[model samples]
Target: MNRFRFRIRFEDRVGMVRDVAEVVSGHGANILSLEVKPGEMHIQVDQVSPTVLENMLKRVQTIANVLEVTPVEWLPHELAQQRLRAILDTVEEGILVVDARGTVSLCNRKAAEILGLGHSLIGNSLKHLGFPREILTSLGVGRLSQQEILLSTPYGRLRCLVKSQPLVDEEGKPAGAMITFEKMSQVRRLVQSLTQPVMITFEEIIYASQKMAEVVALAKTVAKSDSTILIRGESGTGKELFARAIHMASPRRDNPFVVVNCAAIPDTLLESELFGYANGTFTGALKGGRQGLFEFAHQGTIFLDEIAEIPPYVQAKLLRVLQEGCVRRLGEMLENKVDVRVIAATNRNLEEMVAEGSFREDLFYRLNVIPLYLPPLRERKEDIPALAWHFIQKFNQRLGKNVRSLSEAALRRLYDYDWPGNVRELENVIERAMNLAQGERIEPENIILPEKNLASKSPSGLKRAMEEIERQAVIEALNQGGSVRKAAKILGVSHTTIINKMRRYRISGKTSGQWK
Candidate 1:
C-alpha cells in the first residue's frame, strides 16, 4: 500500500471538493484525510496503485474549473515528523520523545550520546533506565518543565539540563512527552567563545606615560613566573588588558586564557563557574557534569577580574585551590590536580577589604605574591595623545571613517579631564568623537566631558559622577529612539555597546529617565 498527499486547486463552487473526493474514492483509493479551503482542497490517500492514482488525477482535472493538481512529497504526518527530525538533528542539544506511559519512543543522536544510551534508546522505560523517580513522576503528571537530571548509564554518570513538555492530541489531551537535553559544558564553552576573545598582546598596550611603561615592564618580567600575580588599579585602568598581556607573554600562552569577572556572576553561580560541579551535584546540572573555568584554564592562566567582589565562601575555596594546587568539584570527593597560573585583578583596594574582614587576608597574601599596580588615566596624562591616536586609527577601521587626528584644542580638552574611567573611558570618548567628527580632525566640541560642577561635587571620586552622566545620556537616547538599536545609532556606537551600557547602568526600556 502506497500513501500520497496532493493539493488540488479549482474554482470556488459547492460540491467541488465532494466531486474530488468522489473521484478519489471511485479510483479504488482510500481517502485518509481531506481539507477543504477557499478554491483549494488538500487530500491524503492510502493504498493506491500508480495507474489508479494517475487515472484519478486525470479524472479530477476533467472536472469543470479545475486549475491545478500536484502531488506532495510526503503525507501530512510523515512530512511533519520529517521536518521535526531534521530540526532536532541540526541542533546541538539532545532531544527525546516518550509515549504517554513514559516509554521512550524516539531519541536523537545527541540525546543518545549525552545520556550514554549508545545507539539504542527507543522502547525503554525511563524508570528502568535509571532516570530519577522525580522525573518519571513529573512525566506521569504531565508537569515536567525544565529541570536538571542525573542519569547513570552504561557509559557513565551524566548531568543534563532537561526540559520536557507533553505532546497533545487533536482534543488537547496529553499523548506523550518531549524532552530536550543540554550539556552544561557545551553551554559554558559556547558562552566563553562568544564573550571572551583574547587577542591583545604586550605591544598593544599603547602608552607614552612613564608610569604605564614601568608597569608594563614589570608585568613582562612577572609573566615569566607561574606565581599568583595580583593587579591593582582604578576601574577601567586596563587591568584586564594587562592580564591578557601577561598571559600572551607567558610560557603557557599557547593554552586557554580564561577570564572571569567575579562581580559579574551572581554569588550562587560563581562557585560552580570556577569549580564545576560533579554529576548529580545539583538539579539542572549538565550530564557528565562540566569543567569549570579553572579546569578549562589548566596549564594556562585564569584571570579573576574584580577579584575583590568574590564572596567570602568562594574566596576560601579559591585559597585552598591556590595552596593545594588542586580543586574538588562540588559534591565530589576526589580532587583534580591542576597546573594553572592564577592572575587576579581588582579595581578596589584589597588591603582595605582585608582590614575590614571583607576579604580574606590569607587569600589576599596569596594573590598579592607579585602585585602590579596600574596607574589611573589621570595620573598618566602623557599617554592621552598616543592612546587617542591609537583609538582614532581603530575607530577609523571600525566606523569606516578616515579620521586622521585630534585637533590641538581637542587634545587639550582630553588632557584636562580626569578620566575617572581611565583608559576605557578615553577609548570610548575618542571613539565617540571619531564617529561625530565632520572632518579628518576631531574638534574640542566632539570630546564630551563631564559637567564641571558635577565633577567638582564628586571631588573624592569622579567615577560616580561620570557614571551618572553616562546613564543620563543612555536614558535620553533610549527615550528619543525607544529601541536599543536606534538609540545606539543616535549615540554613534554599536548596538552591543549600548546594550552592555544599559546593563551596567541597570537601565531598561520601561524605566527610562529614572536613575537609581
Candidate 2:
C-alpha cells in the first residue's frame, strides 16, 4: 500500500467532487483526505498498487470539464504542518501548542531541550509535566500573559518565563493555546551582555605595565573562588571596575552584579537601604517593605564601594550577614536568608580604620578574605600613551570629532605629569582636550591639567611637584648605577649630596613603587 496526494483542477459544477471520489473508488483506492475549491481540489489516498494510482490519475482527467489532474508531494493539511515546523524551528524560544483539553498537540526542538525530555511530548497530558489540573480554568482560557514558573524536570528545577496566547476557531470558540518558554539561562546571558559601559570584564581594564598585568592575573585567579573579595586602592583608582570584573569572571557571572556606593548613602538610611526596612518603619517607607541589595543579589554578587565609610551600627549588621548568610529588616524581628557573594572595595586604609575604631575589626577580616590591590595610573605610566589613545577613540564618538592622535609634545607632557585622579581623571582630560581641539590632532596647548582634582596628587603644589621630579631623577640614576657614588656621577652631584637627598625624600627600593 502507498499514500499518494494530488492536486486536481475542475469546473465549478454540482457533483464534481463526487465524480472524482467515484474514480478513486473504482480503482479500489480509499480516499484518506480531501479539500475542494471552486476550480481546484487537493487530496491524499491510500492506494493498493502503483498501477491503480496511475490509472486513477488518468481516469480523473477524463471526466467532463476536468481540465487537468496533477500529483502533489503533500496534502493541504500536511503542507501547512511542514511550513509551520520550519518556522517554529527557526525561533530560539521553546514553543508548544496544547489543545483545550491539555493534551500536547505540538512541541518544537527547543521545547524538548528546555524540558530535558528524551521522548515525544505530543498527546501527553500537561499534568505529566507538573502542570496544575486547574491551570487552564475558565477564567484563564482565552488569555495568559508572561509569568515566571518553575517546572520540575529530570535535569532539575527548570525555571522559565512562560507566555500563552489562546487559539480560536472561525466562530471565535476557545482553542488550544500557544505557549512560549524563555529559558532562565538565556535570560541571564542577556542581562550580562546589556548595559555596555557598566557590564565590564577583565579585558576592559587598560594597562601596559608588568605590575598591572600581575595584578590582573592575580585578580583572575581569585575570581574563580567564592570568597569575599576586598579591593584596596586609592580614590579614583578604579576599585569598582576591578570589583565588576571579578564578578563577571566568577561562577555567578550570569546572575546580578549589584553595586552600592556606601559613602553616597546617608549614615542613617544606609541600614534600611542595605538590609531593607519593614512597612511603616519610617514615614517614606513602602507599604509592603522592600528587598535589600543582599536579597536582590541572591545567587549573585554585590559590590560595596567605600566600605570603610559604613557606620559602626551598619558594620555590625554587615558582619552578621557575612557570618550567617542572612539579613534582618529594620523594625522587623524576622531575618531573611540570602546567598549573595560579597565584593567590598575601599580606598581608605581599612587596617588603620580598624585600629582607630572607625570600622569594625571582625568585619574587615571577613571582607579581606581575598584581597586585591589595584595599582594607580601614575605607577603604570608606561600605559599612558595607550590609555590616552583609547580615550581619544571613545571621545570621538561622543564629541563628534575626528581627533586622530596626540602630538609628541602632548604625549611628553602626559608622561611628565602626575595623574592625580587615576584612570577616570585621564578620561576627563582627554574629553576636555577633544572638546578644545581645533584640528584633528590634540596638541600640548589643548591638554589642560586641572589645578586640583578630588585632591592634589602632590603636596605644597609646585614645591612638592619639583621635589617629586627630583626624586624620580635621583631614583632613575641610582637604579641604573646601583650605588650613591655612581648615581652622583650621573646626577652631576657629589656622593654626599646624593645620600642626603635620598634620606630627605625617603627614597628606597621599597618606596620607589613600580619605578623599581
Candidate 3:
C-alpha cells in the first residue's frame, strides 16, 4: 500500500471537513489521520496511487467552497513524528521508549550514546539488554514516577535520572511507555547553577540574649563538621535561618544548598521530590525525571524544614539515605551515592512522637546527631530591641521608608507581650508599623497588638487566647479600616489571612459597617 497526504483549503463552513474525508473514502482510500484547522484540512491516506490521488484531489476540488488540494511529501502524522524525533535528537538529554511487555521500542541517538547501546535498540527486550531486574520489575508495575536509577551499561556505571509514563490504548489499557534519561553529573551541574548557596552566615544571626548567643556559638562550632544537625524550636523561631547560617559556614558552602519544607509538599509527592524517579516509571511524570532535593544537594547541604511532618513511609527512605549516604528513586532499586550534610528542623517534639510511636526512633537519632535548640522570642526578650531595629532597617530599605527608630512605649509594649509567634511575629509587627507609622519613630498605637481584654479573660490556654485575640483584632481592624487591604495592613497580616479570618469568625462586611 502507498501513503499520501493532502492539504485541502476550503471555506471554514460546517461539514466542510466531512466533505473532504468523503472524497478520499469515495476513491477506495483508507483515512489514516485527519487534521482540520481554520480554513484548511490536512488528511493522510493509505492504499492510494499517484494517479488515484490526483483523481481524488480533482473530486475534492469539485466540492463547493473548496479552493485547492495539493499532495505533500510527508503525511501529517509522519511529519509530526519526524519533527518530534528531530527535537528529541537535538536535545542533550536521552530518550527511550519501551513496550508494555518490557521490550525496547524506540531510542534516540543521545540515548544510545549515553547508555553505550547500539544505534538500533528497537525490538530488544530490556531484560535481555542486561537492565537490572529490579528496574524491569518497576517498569512492569507502571506506578513509578520521577525516579533515579543507576544503569550498569557498557559506558560504565551511569547514574541517570529516569522519568516514565505509560502509553495507553484507546480502551485506556497500558500499551507501552516512554522514558527520558539525564546523567547525574549533567543534572548536578544544572542544579548547582540554578541553586543559590546559603548567604546567611553566623555573623548575620543577630542576638543579644545569652541563650541565643550560645545557640549561635554551637551552630558555628557544628557547622565545621559533617554531622547531621537537628534544629529544635517553636514555629517562627528562625530555625531555617540557623540552618542557612550553618550551611554557609560549612566546607561545602560553594555547592548547592537545597531546602525542602516537609510540610509544604504533599506526602504523595515528597518521596519522589526528595529521591527523584527513573524514566518511564509512571504516567504524566516529567521527561528525563528530576533530581530530588537530596540529589541536588549532593556534595553540599539539604535542609528539611518541618521535619516532623514527614510521613512514616518516607521516613524509612530518608533514614536509608542518611545512613547509607545514597538514595534510590521511587521505583528503581539501584542507589545513587550522594555526599550531603543534612540539617532537619522541626517545631514539634520528636522525642514525644518517638515515645508515641508516631515518629521513628532510629530516624530521630540519625537526624538529631547534633541537636541545636533555638530559644523562642519571649525567652530572648533582651534581643527584641536589636531584632526590632534590624527589621526596621530592613523594612526601611524594602518598603522605601525612612522610619528612624522605635518609641520607648512601643518597645515596652513589645517586651510586655509574650510573642507566641516568636521572632517572625516581631518582624511582621515592625513591618506593619513601618508601613502605617506617620511619625519618624514607631509609637505604641502603631504597634498592632492582640486584644488585651480577650487575652485577660481567656487565661486557660495561650494558643486559644491568641486566636481569640487575633479574631477580635481582625474584626476591629475591618471596622476601622473599611477595606480588607487596609485592615490587613493595620493588622500586619495578608489580605487573604484577613478574609480567611473573617470567614472563620463568621463576620461579614455588613456587620463590620462597610467593605471597600
Candidate 4:
C-alpha cells in the first residue's frame, strides 16, 4: 500500500476542505489523515498507487491560491485510479467532463442549469459560449483544474463553483480532465420582494385639496426621472414624507434610502459621513475602510434635507460627485463609483441665497432640475378638514383615545384661523384639542386658534398685498384698452396691452358698471 500526502492553499475560507476532500476521495486514495493550517494545509492519503500519484498532484495544484504540491506515496496504482474517477463522478455538484482537447464530455444536471443549456452540452466547446476564455483554455492544456468562473447564458449571469481534476494515462501523465460545478445560491425571493416592493401612488399621498393634488402630481413627474429635485416648503409640510414617497416611486427604490439632515449634523462630521475614509485614514478610522453614505447608498436614493444649510465647501464636493458620478473618500485616492438619486428639501429660499452669494448658482441649477413647491396650509385651506380628520385618527390610534371627529363650530374655527406653521401646526392643535375634549367630538374650546391679532396680521397683510397688486394691474389694463392708442399712449404701454387689459379686468370704460 502506497500513501500520498498533498498540501494545498485556498484563496477564501468557505468550504475549501470539504471540496478538497471530495476531490481526494474521488481519486480512490483512502485518507490516512488530513491537517489544516492558516494559508497552508497538508493532506495525507493511504492506498494511492505510485502510477496515479503524479496525476493527483497536478490536479490539486490547479486550485487557485495553491502554493505547492509534494507527492509522498504508499499505495497500489490501479485501485487508486478507479477510486478517484468514481469519487469525481459521484460528486453532488454538477460536473463538466472534458477531454484534453477541451471538448465537453459529460455534465451533471446542475451544470446544465448553470450554463442555461440543456443536458445536451456533451459535444460543445466552452469557448463557443460566454464562459471566460482563460478558464476554458486552461482546462484544455491541463494546467488548471478549479477556477471560479462567470458564465452568461439565456437564463442570466451565473456564478459557478468550479473544481477540476485530470484524467491520467497508464504512464501517469495527464490525459483528460473533469470539472465539477456548484451553482451559487441566490438570496430568497421574499427578501428581494421586501427590499423592493411596489410604489405608493400619488393618490396615496393623503391630501384632498387641489393644491395638494397638484403637489402630488408634480412629485410624480419628479419621481419619473433621475434628476435632482428640490422640494421647498415649511416645516411640518411633510417635506421628508414626500421625499420618501418620491424615492419609493423612483427607479432607485431597490437600493437604500439614506437621509442626511444638513441642519441636524455638525459641519465638521457631515463631510466624512457623506464620504467614508480609508483604514487608518484618520484617528478613529474603522478596520479596512468605512463606506460613506454614497457608497452605502449605491444604486439608491439620498435625501438631503435642509440642503440650504450645507456648507460651501461641502457643496462643492457634492457638486463634483454629482457631475463625475464618483465619490472620493476623505483620506483615500481611490474614487468609488456610485449611482444615487438625490432629493433635496429646504424651508429657505435657495434663489435668494444664490443672489446673496450664500449659495452657488451652478449647484443651485443642478439641484433645481425638478422643483416642487408645497403650498403652505393657508392657501390649501380646502384640505384642512380632511387633513385634520386624518391626524385625529392617527393620534386617536396612538394615544388609545376614541375620539371620532370634530364639532361643526370647531371645524369652522380650524378653517377660519390662519395656520402659521401650516399642516404641522394644524396637527398640533388637533392633538391638543383631542386631549382636552371630554367627549368623542372635539369642540371649539378644545381647539385653540392662533391669537386673533397674530392671525389677522398675516391673513390681512396677504389679502391687502394681493388685492393691491390685482387692483393696480386691472387699472393699467383698462387704461390701455380705452385709447387703444391714447390710453396706451398715456400709460406708456402698447396698444395690444390696452385690449388685453380690458379683457382681463372685465371693464369697458364707457359702461356705467365700469365707471362705478
Candidate 5:
C-alpha cells in the first residue's frame, strides 16, 4: 500500500484540521493517523499514487492558514513506536501488549525468547497460546490482575507471575492490555539470595535418634505455618540453628531472616533495639531514626534467641508487637504495622521467670504458642557417633587436617561422658581432637573433655541410661555365657534380639570374661 506522511505548518485555528481532512478525502485516500500541535500538524494517509500525492499536497497548500507542507517517510507516532520497542527490549522481563480484540500487537524480543517463539508474535491471538479466552477478554477490556500461574509454552512449562495493565484512550475506554511475564525462578533467586541465606535445613541438624527425629519432623510440620514458634532447649542445644532451619523451610524464606540475641544486648538498649527510637530520641541516634529488628523482619521471620533474657520493659513492648501485629518506636507513639513471623528461642526456663515475676505472664503465653524442644546431646548419645564424624570432616577442611574418623574407644569415651555444654561442647572437643590427632583417626588419647564435664555418672536421660544398662548387661552375660545363645537366656530375650541389641550398641567379644 502506498502510505504518505506530511508535516503541515498551519496557523493556530479551529477549522484548520477540517480543511486538511476534506482535501485528503477528496483524493480518494484514507487518513491513517493525525497529530496536531500549536503551529504544526503531522498526518499519514494510504492508497495514494505519487502523482496523486503531489496534486493533493498542492491543493492542501492552497488552503487558508496552511503555510508550508513537507512530505516525510516517518510520522511522529512511528518514531515513538520505534523508541518504545527499543525501551521494551531493554527490559529484563518479557513484555507483551495485546489490543482490545486479544490480538498481540507488540511483543518484545525477551517475550519471544521466553515463549520459545519466532520474532513474529504480532497479529497472533493470545488465546492461541493456551490462555483462557474469557480471561484474555477480560484483561483485553481492562479488568486487570496480577497472578502467579503456570503457563505452558513451546519451550517448556513455566511458573511465572503475570501482571497486566489496561491501555486506555483519552476518555478512559479500553484500547488494549499491556501484560508482562516474569519467570518466578528469577524472582525467587532475587528474593532469596544464594550465598547470603543462613543455609540451615532440617537435614543439616545431624541427628539419628528417634527423639531428635520426632523433633525434626515436628519442626518441619510447623515450618509451613506463620504462627509464633518457641524453641525450648538448654545452652548449646542448637536453638538458633533450629530457628534458622524453620525460617528457611517456611514460605517466608525468600524474605528477610532477622536474628536478635536478647541476652547478648544490654537491658538498657534492649527496648531501643527491638523497637527503633525516633530521631534525636537519644544523644547518638540515627539521622532519620533507624528501623528496629521487627520492622526489618517485615514479611519474613525474626528469630529472638535467648528470649527469656529480655528485660521486663522490653517484654511488654514485644508483647505489644506480637499481640497487635505492630510496633512503636521508643520515642514515637505511632504504631507501625509489620507482617513478620516471630520464632523465639530460649535456653532458660521462662515459666520459672514468670513465677518469679521477672517476666510478663502475657508475653510468656504469647511466645509459647508452638513450643519445639531440642534434646541435649548427652540425652541422645546415638547421635554422638554421627555428630563426631560430622565435626571431624568439618574441622578437617578448616584446620587442613585429614582426620578420617574417631576411634571406637574415643567414641566410647564421648558416649560415656555427660555433656553439660551439649552439641556446642561436642564440636569444640572434636576440633581439639582434630588438632591433636597424629594418625588418620582420632584416638581416645587425642579426645579431651572439660574435667568438670566428665563425671563418674553416665550420659543423662532414661533412654541412654537404659541403653547403658542393657549394654553392660549384654557384656556381663556374654562374659558369663561365652555365647550369644546363653547370653539371650541370661537377658530373658530371644538370641536374635540379643544379637541385634549388641550390634546396635556396638558390643562384641569372642572369648569369655573378655567382653569389650
Candidate 6:
C-alpha cells in the first residue's frame, strides 16, 4: 500500500500532461493529488503498486521526459486490493488471479469470454478451464511464466495467450500467481488479409514501351478504385492483358479473376454461359443447375474479352447485370444478388458500332467508367528493337538454339518495315527468323519481306535484255566466291560498290555459278 510521487515533463509543456494522465489511467492508477509546475507536474497516488508505477513511468518517459519517481505509503492492503480490482474490472482486457495452488482466486467477465467460460471460474482449478495441468503446476512452482494456448469451446476454437506472474511474500518466496489472456484468432485473420496473393498484377504483364508504361500506370490507378474499366485496342495489342492487370491490382485481387471470350463463343451459348440457367432450363442443364461466371465470380472480378462481339440480346442481359448488380437464370423468376467487378476489352470500335446503331449506348457508358486506350505497334516503333530482342530470347529458349542475338543490319530492316499486326506480328517474324537461322546471329536472309511491285527499268529495249544478262553473270560470279569481299575482288570492283550492286540485283544463290 504505497503511494508514488512522480514528476513528469513534456516537451513544450503542450500535451505531455494529458498523455501522462492517460498512461497512468490505462494502467489502473488513481491520481490522488496533482499540481502543475512550470514545465512539469508533481503527481501523488495511493494504491499503485511498483509494477503499475513502472509501466506508467515507462510510457510517460517515451513521450518527452520524466523527472523523478518516489514512493509514499498511503492505503493499506484491503482497501488497495478493492480499488485495484474495481479499476481492472473496467478494462477491456481479460483479467484473472490464480493462487499458488493453481486455483482461480478471481475472474472478470472479459476473462471468462476470452477463455470460453464464465467468471464462475473463481474457486475452480484453472486446469479445468483448459490451462494444461503441467503448465499450471509449473506456474505455481515459478518455473513457467507465460505461454500461448488454443482453447476449444461450444462457440468455436479460440486462440488464447496467457501471461503469468508469481506473487512473492515478504520472505521473497513464491506464494500466488496471476494470468492474463486475450483472444488470438482476430489477429491471425488480419495478418492473412494483409499477406494474401494477388491473382493478376501489373508486373505480370511485360512491356518496355512508353505507351505501355503509360497504360499500366493508368490501370494501376484505376484498379485501386471501384470503377468499371473498358480496354480498347487492336486484337493483338494486349487489351486483355491490360484488363487482367487492372483486376489484379484492385482490392478484389484476392478473389477470383474469371475470363470470358465473347468472340470465341456463339451468341446462342454466350447468354446461358454468362448468366447461369435454372434447373431444367435447357437440354444439357446440370442436375441442380449451374452458377454463371458472374455468380461464381461474386465478390471478385470478371474479364470480358472481345466484349464488342457480344450479341444484342446478350448485351441487354449484360447491361442488366452491370446496372442491377443481380442475375436471373434463363427460366428463373427470382434474381440473385451478386458483387462482381467488370473489366471489358475489345479490338472493335464500340463508338462506331454505337454510331451504326449496332451496340447499346447505355451499356457502353456503363462499362466505360474508365477507358484505357492502347497504341498499335507501328505507332510505337521505338519499342520494336526491345520487343524484337525479347522475342528472340523467348524463341531461342523454345528452339534450344545457340541464337545469341539479331544482327544490327537485320534489326534495322525489321524496324523499317510496318508491322500491320503489332506485337503479334513482330513475334511471328522473330519466330520465323529463328527457324531459318543456322548460327547464333540472325542474318537479313533469315527475314522474308513482302514483294513490292514496280514498272520494269527498261520497258521496250534490246539493251534491257543485255543488261539483265550482265547482271546474271555478276551474281553468278559472287555466288562462286560466297563471300562479298571475295566476290568484289573476283568481279574487279571495290567491295562496297560491289555489295551495293549485288543488293540491287537481289542476288542470292539459286543458279549458284551460272550465267545465261
lDDT of candidate 1 at residue 151, scale 0 to 100: 66
Candidate 6 — which residues are off by over 4 angstroms? Answer: 1-200, 449-516
lDDT of each: 0.82, 0.81, 0.82, 0.72, 0.81, 0.73
- Runs of candidate 3 exceeding 4 Å displacement: 1-156, 160-183, 195-198, 453-516
Superposition error at 302 for model 1 (Å): 0.4
Q: Which prediction has the highest TM-score against the true structure?
A: 2
Residues 405-473 of candidate 4 have per-residue lDDT tens digits of 888999999988777788888988988988888878998999977677775534587776986686566
- TM-score of each candidate structure, all chains considered together: 0.54, 0.63, 0.57, 0.54, 0.58, 0.50
Please tell me which model should have the higher TM-score, number 2 or number 3: 2
Each prediction's total of clashing residue pairs, residues at least 3 apart in sequence or on different chains, is 8, 0, 16, 15, 0, 1
RMSD of each: 15.8, 15.7, 17.7, 18.9, 20.5, 23.3
Per-residue CA lDDT of model 1 for 1-516, tens digit only, reads 568889888889888977887888899888888877798778899998888888899999999889999988665567788988788788899887897778988888788777776557888887877677766666635656556565676765554667777787888777778877786556545665676685689998899988888988999999999999999988888888888999989998766789899878877799999998877789999865766788777777899998987867999999999999888889888777777899999877778767666779999999999999988888889998899999999999999999887889999999888887888989989988987899999999999877866545254456778888999998998888878788899999987677668655656545754322
TM-score attained by model 6 = 0.50
Instruction: Tell me how far the alpha carbon of residue 118 in candidate 2 is from the true structure, in angstroms, after superposition.
Output: 5.4
Local lDDT at 296 for model 6 = 62
Residue-wise C-alpha lDDT for candidate 3, range 1-516, written one tens digit per residue:
577777888877988977777887899899888887899888888887889877888889999999888877876677888998898799888877887888887888888888786676778777766565655666645755655566778766677766776677889777777777788777877867876653788888888999988888888999999999999998899998998889888898888788899877876788999998866678987655666778878888899998987767999999999999988887677787888999999988888778766689999999999999998888889999899999999998998888998889999999998887888888888998999999789999999977765434335577778888888888889878888889999989887677657645556655656665
Off by over 4 Å in 2: 132-135, 138-142, 191-194, 198-210, 220-229, 243-344, 348-369, 376-422, 425-516
lDDT of 2 by residue, 1-516 (tens): 778888988878999999989999989888889998789999889846988888889999999989888888988788799999899888889887888777788988888888877447888767787654334552227566555455777876555666778887788777778878876556644654574246789999888899889999999998998899999888788888888888889998878888899878877678988997765788987754665677667788889998977767899999999999978889878776677899999887878666655667899999999898888888889989889999999999998999998999999978877787788888888999999999999999998886554246546777878998999899999888877788899999987677657655656556544332
Ranking 2 against 6 by TM-score, winner: 2
Off by over 4 Å in 1: 1-196, 456-516
Model 6, 83-155: lDDT tens digits are 8878877866677787777788888778877766675778887777777655576655664434545455666
Tens digits of per-residue lDDT for model 5, 18-118? 99999999998899999998999999998988898889999999999888999888898889999998999999888888888778988999888877776
